[model samples]
Target: MATQPLIRSDHLFDTVELSKWELEQIMERAAFWEKNWRPGQAPFAGRFAANLFFEPSTRTRFSFEIAEKKLGLHVLNVNMEESSTTKGESLCDTVKTLSALGVEVVTVRHREPEAIQELLTEDTGCKIINAGAGKMAHPTQALLDLYTMKKHFGSLSGLKVAMIGDIKHSRVVRSNCWALGKFGVQVIFSGPESMRDHELEKIASYLPFEEAIREADVVMMLRVQLERHHEQLFVSAGEYFKNYGLSIERFQTMKPDAIIMHPGPVNRNVEISDELVEHPRSKIFAQKTNGVFIRMAVLERALGGVQR
Candidate 1:
């Protein structure tokens, strides 16, 4: 009897589905790829991927571009604002057009996760990667966070990680909770009560203010996006900071080995104090660097490994 191939989800819902061994394999592969980048070694040679970003991105967009190039794939960056979608083309029409163009993977960042799901259901053969989708998921961010934590501590199990600020409107929070929880980390979701998602009870423990930062091994701060305020999700920036922001005084509450992380662009003096952002314990910069390695791993995995 022949063994069946492992069926992985095109949409990375959570990291839990990947076994510990598989996670390690991905990390190891990522580290190796980072150390030894070979020119013209495109596992995706002759293939094309369309970057369909409906929202703004810096790290994710550039990282994917770098990853695809390293793997030898042609990248078609679709500026949604300049596309016919702005002129009233339906999402299905846009996706269909891209699919018809022979793109192999569709990596997208949108305000809605369901939009990606809909595209996947509509397009039978193309692979769909969610770069980010409104407060829903950022799998690559989570992967890089895990890689960063693993590189620092050597493992994620039993680490006390506090996710600070803007839980309600953060895709990073949602993805991290699921990813870190799978590794047996104790995750604390900290923010103003208004920004706390009532639906996150299963994967994280919710806390308010300084209590969440106390003695944690990692304190991950998230930017308080100003757009959320227009939706009435937050009362005011000052009030939000007072309740859950990582002020310098509050930063003193963390364990000595605890590291600070933030997915940039940080709203310094708002979500995190400037001093802490530059402090020795901050791994924000390291996380950004790891973004490239993790993205390389994702592209390699999704594109079927490095080819000669």
Candidate 2:
């Protein structure tokens, strides 16, 4: 029988699906790619990849496009609004069409978590990557976040990460909890009771805002998704900041080496203070920088790069 790929799936849906060994391989490969980047190395010379994003994105979409091109793959980026999907074409039909067009890989971002998985059948020939899928999972973000932390700390075993804000709705948090657990990393959820998830509480401990910040090795703040806004989910932004935001005073209480993180498109002073976003200890930008290499590693492995 042929050996299975390191990811063991044609689609990457969530972090829980990846073993610790697989995570390690991805990080090791990312490190190698980061250090040994050459002017022209095309790992997927003859292959084709497509990015199909139904949601608006600045980082994830652009970074994936860069990774695909860096690997020397022909990339097709479809404008969801301009595409036939807007004319009532189903997602399944659209993806199958890409496969029919000779595209070998497709990275997609949609609101429903199960929507993309519906395309994963014996008949579909293209590989799928979950960029962001509703309130369930953003596996690649979790992968890049883990790679960033591992690259910084050199180990994940004793790390404590406090995930603050919008826990119930943040897919990044959902995937992070799964990835962190595999390495014995302590995961703490901190936010207003409304944003806290009861189901996730079973996997990780819930801590008060101050307590969470004080104990963390990494403080990860989440954006308040105004796009997913429902009535009464938040009050005034000023009031929310006073209670839950990472003000400069709260930042001062943190260990000097402890880093701050946020998955992009920040709400500025809402979840994190404006001043601290670029503080020396902030890994927000580093996370963005690491995202490219980590995604390159993912693209290569998903296309069947030899396991290290």
Query: Which structure among the candidates has the greatest TM-score?
Result: 2
Index of the highest-lDDT prediction = 2
Q: Which regions of candidate 1 fall more than 4 Å away from where they truly are?
A: 1-22, 230-236
RMSD of each: 3.6, 3.0
Give the CA lDDT, 0 to 100, for residue 308 in model 2.
35
Question: How many residue pairs collide in each prediction?
Answer: 2, 0
List TM-score per model, in order: 0.89, 0.95
Cα lDDT, model 2, residue 281: 90
Residue by residue across 104-219, what tens digits does model 1's lDDT show?
A: 67788888778776876775356777898787788889888999999899878889988877788888887777777778889888777667788885667787657778858989
Instruction: For candidate 2, report its TM-score.
Output: 0.95
| lDDT string, candidate 2, 156-241, tens digits | 99999999999988999999999999999999999988888999999999999999999999999998876775767778899899
Worst 10 residues of 2 by lDDT: 1-10
- Residue 44 C-alpha lDDT in model 2: 76
